[model samples]
Target: MDVSRTRVLQLIARPDFPEPYERLAGGSVWLAEDVERWITEHQPWKADQEAEEEP
Candidate 1:
């Protein structure tokens, strides 16, 4: 199975995206459920962060 580096990077960078379990091992952190929980718990904070980044 071949995966593009760009696509893999995108998944790692996005907070709302769900990553595969295998990816979590071998120092590739961030679980899918954790991301979901973070989004749920910090929706306002996440929005604020995005808003602050925008012009």
Candidate 2:
């Protein structure tokens, strides 16, 4: 999930990515838990990010 904003846009555009729970004037909103689950299941690279963040 440590990706560029453009990359995020591309990911969200894909059919498999979750639909935004709500669309606001600022931008679409997705549930944090939903996105975290998606990242854990689909983006294994996130494990590396977590490892790096640990004290």
lDDT of 1 by residue, 1-55 (tens): 2459897686567765555456444666667576656655656576566557778
Where is the poorest 10-residue window by lDDT in model 2?
43-52
Top-scoring candidate (lDDT)? 2
lDDT of 2 by residue, 1-55 (tens): 2689999889998887888999999999999888877877888698668758888
TM-scores of all models? 0.29, 0.75
Candidate 2 to truth, TM: 0.75
Report residue 39 deviation for candidate 1 (angstroms): 16
At residue 33, candidate 2 shows an lDDT of 82
lDDT of each: 0.62, 0.84
The 10-residue segment with the lowest total lDDT in model 1: 16-25
